[model samples]
Structure formats: structure tokens, C-alpha cells
Target: MIWFYERRGEHLRCEIRQQLEGDQFALVVTMPDGSERVELFEDSRILNVRSVELEKLLRSKGWDGPFARDI
Candidate 1:
């Protein structure tokens, strides 16, 4: 998996790793060097997500937009 990083605040960071298996999307995230960890979102909520709007949500979450520019 590729490394995904985001600036949470002025100097905070959120790191993530993602992958897809079968019909589900697997996502894991950690903040402040694994201080607060979250993982295994079943992704059932994404069933009706449209690509265009998904991009917008990512931006709002401080994702830096995309892999190319963010990384």
C-alpha cells in the first residue's frame, strides 16, 4: 500500500493506508504517530457515493486532494 499523509492542523498529521478487497474498501488511519487509530470501515456507506462528490469530500477533510499532489 502507498503512504497517504494529510496535514490535520498547523503542524498535526494524519496518515492512512487503503486497499480494496472483493467488493469492499479497506481503510486505516492513524494520527499523531498512531496515537488515535481507526480502521476497517466496512464502506457500506459508500454504496451511493458519486465520484465527483467523493472528491469534494476528500478535499474538505484536508486530504490535499489526490495522491499525486498530496504525496
Candidate 2:
């Protein structure tokens, strides 16, 4: 799954997918500046929790989404 947030004409991306190397999942965040951060999780539950937390954090910081697609 993927989500996008926007602020001041910049975009932030968040994507979640299963990793090929193990029974793990990845939470990949692409910052507006173009740097990327990858986080691994043992299961979907934890990944989902973290995803929600991230969305809330970004919203509090004045970003605009959880958007299903880039705007």
C-alpha cells in the first residue's frame, strides 16, 4: 500500500510491502527532500501501527494527507 502527504508544494511518500529476503515487511518513507528511510517489521500488525503513528505525526506537523495517490 502507498500514501502521500503534501505541504507547501512538497510531497512525502510512504509505502508498505513485503520484503523478499525474509518473512518481513518494509515501511519505506521518502522525504520531500528525496532522502529515503526504510524500516523493517516482523509482521503486518506492527507495520500498520507504525504507519498510523507516522500519518498522525505528519498531520500534526501540517502535512495534508494519507492520500491514496500523489497530487
Candidate 3:
């Protein structure tokens, strides 16, 4: 899998990952407490999400930082 990630100081981090096979994707948000919330998506759902929606999803999961694009 490949990840696109952003860090918010030492408190939080979030990453979006795509599998090598390209069948599914996952969003992983890491909180200050070192716990993670991961959600999996089908290819269509992942590909169809807009940047705004992505940020919203992150916020809902407790990440209050700007979104980062995949490098």
C-alpha cells in the first residue's frame, strides 16, 4: 500500500492508503493517544471522494488539520 499523510505537530496524523492491487483503499487517522481509526472503501467510493469530502471525513474522525495530497 501507498499512503498520503499529513502530520499535525505531535498530536495527530492522518493517512489515506491505496492498495497495490488497486481494489480498495483505507483511511487511517491517528489521534494524540496513539490509537488509530481505520476505514476501508471500495475502489469506486475511494476514487469518487472529492478533496472537500476527504477533509470532512478527517475532521469527523478527529483530525483538525489541513489535508495533504499524495506525493
Candidate 4:
């Protein structure tokens, strides 16, 4: 799954996908500057926790989304 957020015309992207090599999940974040950050999770519970935390953080910082696509 993927989500996008924007503020002042800059975009932030988040993607969740399963890794091909193992039973792990990846939460990838793409910053507005084009840099990337990755977090690996062993289970869905923690992944959901972190995902929501990031969403709240971005919203508090004045970004608007979890849009289904880039806007």
C-alpha cells in the first residue's frame, strides 16, 4: 500500500510492502527532498503502530494527506 502527503506543494510518500527475501515487511518513507528512509518490521502490529505515528507526526507538522496518490 502507498500513501502521499503534501504541504506547500512539496510531497511526502510512504509505502508498505513485503520483502522478497524473507517474511519481513518494509515501511519506506520518501521525504520531500527525495531522500529515503526504511524501517523493517517482523509483524503487522508494530508496522501499523509506526505507520499511524508517522501519519500523526506529519499532520501535526501541517502536511495534509494519506492521500491515495500524489497530489
Candidate 5:
């Protein structure tokens, strides 16, 4: 299971995890950088989100793409 969150003045945080509720999965949250808030979402919402969507979300949240790529 994976959950994601964005907070003021911080990088994106994602949680990758696995759990079993009698064969179900545990909720996971991955954040390389600590955040002020973590948003909990529905299980259904975690379904089939692509990397492109992530990049778009990051951009929408003011994540500037790559650094010094052309340098």
C-alpha cells in the first residue's frame, strides 16, 4: 500500500507499505522529507495512479522539474 502527501515548504512524501487485514493490505506512507501534514485517502483512490500523474501533481504543487540537467 502507498499513500502520498504535500505540505507547505516541503518536498513530496510518499509511503510504500504492505499489510494484511486477514489477507488485506496495510496502509503505507512514504516520505523522504518530513511534512507538516499527512493526508489520508480512500483505498479506492490508491488504484492505478501513474508516474505521469505524480509528476503532474508535483508540478501543480510547485515542484520544479530536475536540476542542472543541461549544466
Candidate 6:
């Protein structure tokens, strides 16, 4: 329920909330319209996802990656 992006044009605020599913991290995307979308990443898809690699992954999906939330 945190603001991930500022409202701009057609893009509303987006958020990346993490959920604990088994031993993996479930990244839940909360869209501007209050809709939720979950992205599942296989081990192969994230086994090497670190720093720059992870940033590229998120950027590929139109995300700005994780950032500090403003109070």
C-alpha cells in the first residue's frame, strides 16, 4: 500500500509488495487502479539476478526497481 510511482499521464502510482511464498519471494504489483498483479520468476530467471542484473530485470518490465518510500 505504499507509493511506488508518482501519478503521471496514464501511469498511476505503482507498488511492489513482497509476499512470502514457501522459500521464494512473491513480488506483487499493485497497479494504479487498485488492481493487483503477481509476477512469478523461476529459479533460472532469477538465479543470477543481482544488482545490475536485477535492475535490468525490473526495467524490462517497466519498473523503476525498489526505492525508499516517502513518508
Q: Give the TM-score of each candidate.
A: 0.32, 0.92, 0.52, 0.93, 0.33, 0.44
lDDT for every model?
0.44, 0.92, 0.61, 0.94, 0.43, 0.48
Query: Where does candidate 4 stray beyond 4 Å?
Result: none
Question: Which rank order by lDDT, best down to worst?
Answer: 4, 2, 3, 6, 1, 5
Indicate which candidate wins on lDDT. 4
Model 6, position 57: C-alpha lDDT score: 57
- Residue-by-residue lDDT tens digits, candidate 3, 1-71: 22233445545556667768767776776766789888777865554474458667766865556735445
**Per-residue lDDT of 50 in model 2:** 93
Clashing pairs in 2: none
**How many steric clashes between backbone atoms does each model show?**
0, 0, 0, 0, 4, 0
Clashing pairs in 1: none
Scored by TM-score, the top model is 4
Rank list by TM-score: 4, 2, 3, 6, 5, 1
Q: How would you encode candidate 6's per-residue C-alpha lDDT over 15-68 as one tens digit per residue?
A: 333445654444455666778766554452463343346445556767653455
Error of 1 at 23 (Å): 10
What RMSD value applies to candidate 5? 7.2
- Range of the 10 consecutive residues with the lowest summed lDDT in candidate 6: 6-15
Reference-based lDDT, residue 39, model 6: 53
Across 1-71, the per-residue lDDT of candidate 5 in tens digits comes to 33344455444444423333343333333444543333333353452353346657766866664232232
Q: What is the lDDT of residue 28 in candidate 6?
A: 53
| RMSD in order of candidates | 5.8, 1.6, 5.0, 1.6, 7.2, 5.2
Q: Against the true structure, candidate 2 has what lDDT? A: 0.92
